[model samples]
Target: MSKPLGKILSEGKTKKVRETENSDVALLEFKDSITVLDGEKMDVLRGKAVINAHISAYFLEILEKKGVPTHYIEFVEPNMMKVKNLEMLPVEIVCRNIAAGHLVKNYPIKEGTLLNPPVVEFYLKDDARHDPMLNEDHFLILGLASRGEVKKIKEITLKTNRILSDALKAKGLTLVDFKIEVGRGTDGKIYVGDEINGDSMRIWEVGTDKILDKDVYRKGGTMEQVLNTYIQLYQKLLGKMPPIRGTKNE
Candidate 1:
């Protein structure tokens, strides 16, 4: 169903908006759009809408099964889901299982190294500000969350990372890293909100160096191929027939 104009709420890179029947809930229409390098106006990957919808639905279902709090209700369409509206926290939680990118650039660390306990990093959610990294002390200093809340966030985030990593590994994809955002409800309980699609994760091929994330688009790779890979992975997880592979744009 198209979003009723009176109920339209917020819209992001790959999703549209509409208020749901619940006053505090909204309907999210995931678009077939792809962005890279943190929305730096990168090329839009074709077939992204279908791929991301499948991926997000699968992960949300997984979180529901694991007893974690989330905002998702049910998929209303091939590219839409209903969820609770939340006062989104102004931080992006990134948990890295392998050393890569900024970690190597900012610290004296070797690339492809393993983080025994994994590394949980936070950044301000301000897109214009370039999402600066933050520590626990920084989180507290900014009053973004209380000490107890921060602890709870860490616990949930790490748990999510571990579970998704193992899950992707089972499908021949290594979860090198991923980003998450949490929001608090009126009762002060944190629910995993926002989209949890393939766009928010770094999925790598197990044996080879094939990357299935938006990185493929950032590097000017085959957008259609990359998006199809993500959709294929999601289809595999959901026990559904995958979409026919489309010809790559080269």
Candidate 2:
């Protein structure tokens, strides 16, 4: 049986975390609201949440199967899932592969240039501050995470990148770059938390560099175009396209 959803614990642009009867468990509900420019630009894409729930579940499950610890517990049909109620950090870990997005904008590195060894960066999850990048010393000085925790987090993150990169490559997609959130669980262990869907990652088609992820929306693609890309990517990667519960596909 499933636990009853409780009051809102927190909400972000595309998801909401709800409390549950079990203190260590929480309900994560996906929101159809999609935003770009750090929530400045937004729109409601019906059924977006439902499909991303599936996308995130699919990827996180892969990580779990490969022995990666995660807060994802179980996926609930439609729009919600159960997850470990962790003491989530206000940080985001970004791993870059081919240069694009901010990498190109912030640095002289040309877009699409391959990053040797793949740069992994830490960032403070502050929207108002534009989620400023943090160095290892910054992490320790600001008490964002302990030294050991930071080391472990980076190890896990890099390993996750390898696991996911290979997985997507097998499907003819390139893992351009992605960000993930980590939290300390009640078990005193760090875990990969938050959703790992197209929203959190840049996935491009290999040879043609066709957009197969949220860049479709981020770069000004229309709702129908973006949704179509998400749907097609799901079916392409997972090989099945069930009718999404909240969209016309249903």
Candidate 3:
């Protein structure tokens, strides 16, 4: 099940990629495996890949309808997505609506503090360096992105945060913070790329800090609890249970 040379692309903790039947498209095969703390903590959660693929597709479609450009093409399988092949930008755009994670650990911010206007941060996408935080000047110094490009990335990220936060609020969940990657397509336009699932976001039950996202896996939560929370979220947003991989129907 391996793709030919030049057809196979990059691999990450939870995803693999190969060329699709369409030359301009690629298939992202999500895996059941999960990684946390910079891949130091890892495990296999049955059915997770399927759930994430479906959830990512759901959000991408909604964002597309809202005039946000993304690389998403379609869900080709329960655990695979067909997307436009992109020259990914080497940065991770993060928008935080609440003080948590590194925000609290690195800064003096108190946990649960509401960021009235969500804070946007950028990190150079270098795993070996643990993805060091970057500023606009850093982007210029490293030749990673132009100031204009950085500005646009921030704008799009903030808009996405609003859209996702509102969507989750309607489902009785809160979007604590999320990270997104962007890329340039063959069309010569920058679009949001990569998947947006529980792994990329921190979600909590409305009005309470009941973790419902990957933070569970990071914090030693059980796989059963993690999968159940993901299922509940999908059911709330999509009005149906996601088909689990390895099942007859899936």
Candidate 2: tens digits of C-alpha lDDT, residues 36-117: 8878999998878888898888889999999999998999887888999989889999999999999899999989999989
Q: Give the TM-score of candidate 2.
A: 0.95
- Candidate rank order under lDDT: 2, 3, 1
List runs of model 3 lying over 4 Å from the truth: 1-7, 245-250
Residues 1-250, model 3: lDDT tens digits: 9554336677888998887667888888889998987788888889998889999998999899888899998887658888998989888899999999999999999999999889999998877899999999999999888888888888889889989998899889899999999998897778999999899999989877688788877887788887887777777778777787544445
Full-model lDDT for every candidate: 0.77, 0.89, 0.87
Score residue 23 of candidate 3 by CA lDDT. 83
Top candidate (TM-score): 2
TM-score of each model, paired residue for residue: 0.88, 0.95, 0.93
Tell me the tens digit of each residue's lDDT in model 1 across 1-250.
8654435687787778787667887777877677756687655555566667767878988988887788888877556787887777899999988887678879998978889899999899877777888888887889899888889998999889878887787878788888889999877888888778667877778888577676666666675567666755665566564443453321
lDDT of 3 at 57: 94
Error at 45, model 1, angstroms:
3.0
- Please identify which of the two predictions, 2 or 3, would achieve the higher TM-score against the true structure: 2
